[model samples]
Target: MTPTDTRALVAIDLGAESCRVSLLRWLPTGPQCTLVHRFLNNAVETENGLRWKIDAIEAGLMEGLHRCAAIATEGVRSIAVDGWAVDYARLDDDGKAMEDPYCYRDVRNITSEESVHAIIPAAQMRVLTAIGIMRINTLYQLYADKLAGRPQAPWLNLPEYILERLGGRRVSEYTNATHTQLIDMHTGTWATGIFERLELDPEMAAPLVLPGSIVGKVTGELATLPAFADTQLVAPCCHDTASAIAGIPDAADDWAYISSGTWSLVGTLLQEAINTQPAREENLTNFGGAGGRILFHKNVNGMWLLRGCLDVWRAAGKDWSFDELLPLAEAQHTPHHLLDVDDPDLLLPGDMPNRINRQLLERGFGEISTKPEDAPAMTALILHSLAARYAQVLGAIADITGKKLKKLYIVGGGSRNALLNRLTAQATGLEVVVGASESSTLGNFAVQMAAVESSADAETIAEWAGVLRTAF
Candidate 1:
């Protein structure tokens, strides 16, 4: 692809199982981003909690930046990092990371959510902040830490912390801030009221900045590097879901989006946050989106169930690639059993096979397959269950928001699942559009381009994104 006319900007998207770093070369006609590097990301079960291998991710990020520095024709202009939310890195008095951030699936929230909900009823909590109730949310994680007798560390959320570590200022992007449940959706500030009820200090939460704001520039040891001199840091809907939504090329308001990935986030963008009781009852979250929009969606257990089940089978010596199993699983005619994928029991850790089997039995789906060959059917059943659940969430979103959904754009790693995508289309009965495998990074670049452009608007960003897509 011919490179674009404008200067290059890099975006780093940190994910649960992987980290991606890309460079967007903006042209007068449009833009194009080349992924310079990608690396495996893993969370370790630490003595304190389930935490990210933060240093490794940093090393990987730097290596990617170094690659960007190497290939840049004209000097690169800026860099930014965005990742999944709720996980944060504790910092010392001098701002060094005291410890790695905890993974959202760390299972530490065994008892903390109830405690927070006791004082703030689920419905009131929604009215207070317009945050949908969910078990793995940041509020629950924070309460879990306190209940475990751990003191609050002078911590920074991942997005702010990454920029700070790169010698940028400290501030959480508004989109990511909304996930913490510590931010009041109404005031666009930290929810001191919620923190007080939980008896936790609220000052440690990061400040908010709009998407596309220049956070700072690369400094520290890497500052001397050739590529670091002109590198600017920008926050673009740093939350994975928010960035994914921003990357949608279509501008039609009637279209919904399913950020199909480890978590299936299904929703439509709204200018106003829907804090009504029905929205709360449906557990529909209204997170901050790019261009000051709200992402009205629900988090469905996405590819994680499949990934976890495969992990268990792989441990038993049945090496299976997703591609290898897709056809076999797809051929499994009628589902022998289906799961209520949203069941809280499915969210925890254990022998996922046993757990799924137990669930099937509990639901009166009868006995499950015991042989290794039975896995394809079981996996298909899981996917079918997911599609069924997606239908429920899609309808729920429309019902709560009163918005007519024209289409659903699926993005991210799991968006590549053709089998599941087709099923999702059939279930929702809405036109399905498969979008960027690197949507979050694209959104990051789109926001940066918008920030740098003279007249930035959501429509403008989406238009630029359509042009930038030639890189794919």
Candidate 2:
């Protein structure tokens, strides 16, 4: 590839609900972005359990890359990948997949958490990994596998798996690996102690690499594409939320971020890990982030709650679109039932409307209607509940971190919901700054540019990020 400062960069962002491949091309005026391709992503239900359609994802990604190559006549400098964390692909000795990866929502971990807690106890685990205890965490999933007599195979998280498929070395990105609850928060490395306690093979894990590190270059058939020739594969905060946080143009201390998507990760950046008793009790997590910062956040249930109700409606032959629902929701003014969005029951896939009502009744609140005509009320309820949770989490973050959070930045696809944004601002009483809807992709591009133009070191990448603010 030609040595040019202004070549295009491709960002592949994998989400639990959907995935998109974005092309960031430097133009004469500034940087321009094209969402080259996008598609709905879901876990396939099977006789055994829920599994990610990895083959379908691979096909979609190939088509997207072809489209990027067609449009990027000037050639692409490098590519990066980021995605949702925790779930991983198990590979055999020959580096072949054992089966389609299990979805994080699979119920196999329900009984697994108790077993894990028995081994290390929740309090000690939190102090060890500095991760919030959750059934969806990889540690529980792996323990579930062990309980089921599944074969011990090497594993790689989704983004890292994609990198390995792209001729990059097998390695886990720091930001995403923390979500697995397998990394030691203090050493910033794999927690070998946990591995020993659980009787898991430490060799199954790939070595940890920090965000912005160039893992490898485009090789095989992909390298033959004109746009991909000599393209380097950089890991940009491989966790999608981390990438979204990295994309925020401003780096002021007083502003916090909400990486709003299927899940709302609300928190601020920190320089060190917080493993105090209060943080553990509040279920706050401290994960590595871009620029050598720590992401101290809480995972609040987000759009998935509404999407669940939408699924129930569609399955009942009463389909409705967001455009149809949002306006109606905005038109309604009556008080609706509020929910604890993080209720464990709502985390599962099916019968969301019934689940919401069940939760309401259990909490001594009146149930709301889920009929197509009552979509407005149900939508309103979800939004109000989420906004309230955002406010609550923001307050806790301030108390725990002792940071005076003055501004809240809502970045990611959920930022487009004006109704929720208004509620978030009002509820939190903080200056709300709405950022680009494609924050994760933009952050991926920024890191790729830094890796190509200068170095991927945290300090250098952060300096380049400041200079490239106008480009976004």
Candidate 3:
């Protein structure tokens, strides 16, 4: 423990498919992190659409925090949270959430998105915000809400929504806010003009805060947790991708960040948005980032293809594990065909392999196999295709931004896949550093440390980040 006894922070990270709560503590043994709890998270589809079950997730985190409180002799100094971007909740005037927010994978926005393109034109939005042309963006999601008739819900982005209900403050973090596509590229604030265009109530949107800001503290029954009542709640690059990028140890100019998870977020950090014509054509995004940087990245269809294939295979009784599939595919040699992971059809959930096969057939690749042996080969091909796509997208990001990124850092769950990693290194032709798979947790702790110190600036945060490079 530290000389004063309080030697750590808590960071809670939520994802589309899972959630984790960990305690980062320092001791004579040096720094260590204990994962107090983790749970699977899947959007529960409702009459409205696919949405997160926040109550269940919060319950899991509470149980985890309680466990951490039991283990630590002294209370942690602070806590922070980060989660998947683009999904959020509506709050009532009293600050209670109206309902669980829609999942980014929901389909209703498909219709409204075309209208979004018509308003600003997809090309124009790309030039203005450097965001990709996706129907599931916050802009399209909010537009879908206005069409549904319930207009004036309280403004709370996902992490803020959860933190607020736990007695923490209600506000949006800029890194996550940029994912909303409603934030101005240059000003780094909500684009009032875009909201006006969508007829969205500006009041319903929360104010944008930055990473390392202390919003509030957990309250209500949660406040009763031993050693946690006095802990401050910090906003730490609240978007999982943003946090993952922040976790990268290097501060050099020519580095790229590949926050590999369910999705492969391949991009680099920039001082400002790359809102250029070529960037627009490439559908490259300039999302708000940690340390006041921009995350210029693209979402590549990632391990989802393989996972989805396994899911279907398991239902059919094959029950193959990823470990098993890796070797099987590695040994087999088969002629390959590829499908664009970003195809609109693949965006919505269902039989992913079937969708992939169907798309391949439409593109004249012919039908694929249902045999177990084929799963591995197909999965490898999928990974290779993803690597190729990453290279393609990064090339454009480099062209549009005029930045020469020579190194790539891969983090999150998918980074554990060595096969994909080697292929990515080969495809990008850059020196690759395998980062701690739990980058969000590191980033969460980083921001908490910075928030506790009022004088901490971007440079200071970057310096302290060396602590993370060692923690792993």
Give the TM-score of each candidate: 0.95, 0.96, 0.95
- lDDT tens digits by residue: candidate 2, 1-472: 1225677888999998888998888777667788889998999899889999998998899999999999998888888999999999998766656789999999899989999999999999999999989889999999999999997789999999998888789999999999999999988989999999999898999999888888999988989988888788888889999888887767568988898989999999998989899999999999888878899999999889888888888878888888888888988884555788999998888888889899989989888887767878888888988999999999999999999999999999999998899989989999999987888887777677767776665565555555455455
* lDDT tens digits, residue span 1-472, model 1: 2323356888889888889989876555556578889999978877877788888988998899888888876767777778898888778888877767778877767567778878888778888888877777888887887887777876677877888988888787888889988778888888898888888888777677888888788888777877667777777778988887778877778888888777888788998988877787788888998888889888888888888888888888897888899999898896855788988888876577778888888887776674566789878888999998999999988887787887888888888899999988998999888999888887777777777663346776787567666756
Task: Report the Cα lDDT for candidate 2.
Answer: 0.87
Model 3 spans with C-alpha error above 4 angstroms: 1-5, 454-456
- Which pairs clash in model 2? none
Stretches off by above 4 angstroms in model 2 are 1-4, 334-337, 457-472
Clashes of each: 3, 0, 1
Please write out the lDDT profile of model 3 over residues 275-372, one tens digit for every residue.
77777767778887777788888877777777778878888778887687777665666446656877778766888778888888889888778666
Span of 10 residues, lowest total lDDT, candidate 1: 1-10
How close to the true structure is residue 163 of candidate 2, measured as C-alpha lDDT?
Answer: 86
Cand. 2 TM to true fold: 0.96
Query: Model 3 shows how many backbone clashes?
Result: 1
Better candidate number, 1 or 2, judged by lDDT: 2
Name the Cα RMSD for model 1.
2.2
Q: By TM-score, who's the top model here? A: 2
Better of 1 and 2 by TM-score: 2
**Model 1 vs. true fold: TM:** 0.95
